[model samples]
Structure formats: structure tokens, C-alpha cells
Target: MFEISDTQKIGVGLAGFGIFFLFLGMLLLFDKSLLALGNILFISGLACVIGLERTFRFFFQRHKVKASISFFGGIIIVLTGWPLVGMLFEMYGFVLLFSGFFPVAINFLRRVPVLGTFLNLPGISGVLDKLSGDSDRTRV
Candidate 1:
């Protein structure tokens, strides 16, 4: 049986093509005239190769060290005249910071008086679950 889910098929196909494009892009990078195409292919391939879930988890998961590294790395890159790479690093840094901070903020708020009650409210809790993207739907 060669049965495959649509999601799996898409993911696999994208990954395959992504690898090819990524290599092609890297190879083409040596030619200044074709650098633009290389950049497009590289970015597209990278996006396809990683897929959204992994990318989201990379940014959203708890990773203080990685985030700090990215933030500072971006700064260093910018200083070295690589604005584009620096921008990417900075973007990752901001996302990592947000992801890392939100949970801490939520925990701190939970200890507050009125805010804690509001956070525990049924409607508010639902929103929190949605924001946190927890599939289990269980409460603490």
C-alpha cells in the first residue's frame, strides 16, 4: 500500500525540491550576476525545507541561549556590513524574546490579585489556551 496523507506528501515533496534549490542557490551565489536568483532560490528553499511547524517551534520554544546568541549575532553581522543577515538574526531574536517572555509574564501575572482572577476566568483561559496553542485543552 502506497498510501500517504496529503500533508506528508506535501512536506516530503517540498523538502526534496528544497534541498535541490538550496544547493543550486548556494552554487549560484558565486556568480555576482546571478546572486539575486540565488538569493530567491535560497530563501524559498530554506522556507520549504524547514516547513512552518519547525520554524514556529524554533522561534516559539523556550531557548534563552539561542535567542541571546541570535540577537547579538545580528548586531555583530550588522556591524560587519551584512544588513540582510543581520535583519534575519534580529527578527529571530525578537521572536525568541517574545516567545520566552510571554510565559514568564503570564506566570507573574497569575500571582497578581485581580489579574490572576481574570486570567483564570473561563473565557480568558480559552483565549490563553489558543494563544499558547496547546492542543490538550487541559487546565492546571
Candidate 2:
């Protein structure tokens, strides 16, 4: 059992991680429902992931066709796997949603040519690479 003793969250990824832990810690501290808070945050994160991915692809891509196709494909993957986790292990659906959704979306963002390359400025590249693990040479 890993304990979150220190609350000093200092890093570029602080916003992303700190919020989750803050809520989790509070839940533990107050003896409140933790899985519920975790569930809500994860679900909200999943929705944000979908919205961000679609919006970025829509504005950046030449046409809507590709984005629609990709979005539907992502939907299929997330939806199909969700039920299986429930049946197999009483899993949290949002866990499947966020963990599966974010990686592909971030990878897609890093692959976008001009926009992605623009985002690769200095510290940002390291952040993106670390978040998505995309090693495509074009990004560098």
C-alpha cells in the first residue's frame, strides 16, 4: 500500500497528477468515499479527452471525415473493453476510459505536423513525449 505522505507536488505534470492525489488524499483523510471521487474524476477526464481529441483533429485536419472516422474507432475500442472489465473484475469503467483514451489522443496530437511541431518548443516536447511516449522523429 503506497502512502501519499508528502503533499508538495512540484513538477510540470503537477496539474494533472496533483488534482487526483489531492482528492484521493482527502477521501482517505476524511474517511469518505474514495472510489467515488476517483470514479468521477476519471469519468470527467475521459470526457475531456474525447472532446479535446475531436476538437483538435477537427480544426487541424483538412476535413471532418478523418476525425469522424478516428473518433468512432476510438468509441468502439473504449465501449467494447468497458463491459469486459466489469464482467471480469468489477473494474472501474472510467479507468478503462481515461487510460485508453488519453494515450491515443496525445499521440495523435504529437503527430500533427505544423501544429504539433510548433508545440514541440523546448520543455513542451519533453512533456509531450513523457505523457504519450511517442518516439516519432518528426516530433523532434
Candidate 3:
């Protein structure tokens, strides 16, 4: 069985709430306040979950400097107004930061009952394959 510490549990809750607020903010036409709150919560939660040192290491890694700058810059922009533009920058940063994990995420999603069925559809499957960089692998 896997064990989770108290701080990590709290971190998960904070991260979930952050995601919820982000969705709500977008739904409400990108409210700056909610988006900013979500950003803070998400970053703090990440630090809590991974430990502050690890979080710092992850963001400050040599290759990730640009992405970290973009992501943090977007947060600053959002705080200064211009939610939509800030979100665009954040999206770019997020994609760059997480691109390496896409393949693992895609493979995990492919195992979920409902999502797996939907993703297995010809068109969607092809797209997922390309996104995950699995296009070169033979598909059964």
C-alpha cells in the first residue's frame, strides 16, 4: 500500500481546489482574481507536495528556466490585469513544462474504461499518438 503524508494530503486538496477555481475562473470569462488565487494555490500546493527544495529544483533546472520565467511572468501579468493574455502565456509555459509527461499521461488515460474507449477511436487515437510522440510505435 502507498503511504501519503499529512502535508501531501493537504497539498492534494489545495491542488484540486486550485484546478477547480481555475475552471470556474475560465467559466466566468477569465476572472483575474480567481485565476490569481488559483495560481498561488497551485504553486504552493506543488511545493508542499514535492517539498520546497524539489519544487525549486524542478522549476530552476537549467533547461526549464524559460518555462519557469514564462509561467511566473504570466502569474505576474494576471495579477497586474489582462487575464486572457496572461493565460495564453501560462498555457505556453505549462505545455513546455509538462510536455515530457504527456506520453505517460496518455498511456495512463488509455487504461481508463470510459476514456480509453473514447481515445481508442481512430481519429482521436491518431491525435493522441502524435501528441504522445508514440506515432512511430506500431499500433495493434
Candidate 4:
């Protein structure tokens, strides 16, 4: 079985709170302070969960350099009181950074009962497929 350390557990909680704050910030029309807090919490949580060295390695990898710049730049922008633009930059960086995992995530989601059914719908499935970069594959 896999073991999660106490620090990682705390990290998970912090990351969850970060995500909640991020959502709330958006709900409140992109409040700068909440977004900044979320960014700080999320980054710290990630470092705690994975270790500072690993986090640094992950972000600074050659192929991920641009993504790292965009993601951190977005955080800086948010801290400077440009929440909307910062969020947009972050979104782009996030998508570029995580696109490779989309197919795996989509496939996993397709197995969850209610969500699976909803995802299998024509329009939804098509959009998911496109986003996952699986649109070129012929489904059996």
C-alpha cells in the first residue's frame, strides 16, 4: 500500500483550501487578495507535498520553462492587483503544463457512474475528447 506522510496530508488540506479560496475569489469577481492567498497556499502546499527540491525541479525543467514563467508570472500579476489578466495567464500555463495528463484524467472520469454518463453524452464527449487530444483517434 502507498503511504502518505503527515506533512503531505497537511499539504493536501492546504491545497484544498487554496482551491476553495481561488473559487471563492473568482465568485467574488476576482478579488486580488484572495487570489494571492490562494496562490501562496497552493504553491506552499505543493512544495510541502512533493518537497521543495522536487517542486523546483518540476517547475524548472527545460520543456516546462515557459509554463513555469507563465504560471509564476500570473501569480506576480495577481499580487500586483491584476486578477483577471493573471488568471488568464495562469489558465494558459496550466493547460499547457497539464495537457499531457488530460487523456488519462478523461479516461478515469469516464468510469465514474453519473459523471461517466454525463461525459459520454455527444457534445460533452466530443469536447472532452478534443481537450484530451484524443479527437483524432477512432473510438470502437
The candidate that achieves the highest TM-score relative to the unseen native structure: 3
Name model 1 segments beyond 4 Å from true. Answer: 1-3, 30-55, 64-140
Candidate 3 to truth, TM: 0.95
Candidate 4's C-alpha runs over 4 A off are 136-140
Q: What is the lDDT of residue 5 in candidate 3?
A: 99
lDDT of 1 by residue, 1-140 (tens): 77656655565665556446434534754232233333344334434556667655654556566885786576566456665676578568757766745666776786699998889788887776666654465566
* Deviation in Å, model 2, residue 121 alpha carbon: 1.9
What's the distance in Å from true for residue 11, model 1?
1.2
**Model 4 score (lDDT):** 0.90
lDDT of 3 at 45: 90
Give the Cα lDDT of each candidate: 0.59, 0.46, 0.91, 0.90
Steric collisions counted per model: 0, 0, 0, 0
Judge candidate 3 against the unseen true structure and give its global Cα lDDT, from 0 to 1.
Answer: 0.91
C-alpha-based local distance difference test score of model 2: 0.46
Q: What's the CA RMSD of model 1 in angstroms?
A: 15.2
TM-score list, all predictions: 0.31, 0.27, 0.95, 0.91
The worst-scoring run of ten residues by lDDT in candidate 4 lies at 131-140
Candidates sorted on lDDT, descending: 3, 4, 1, 2
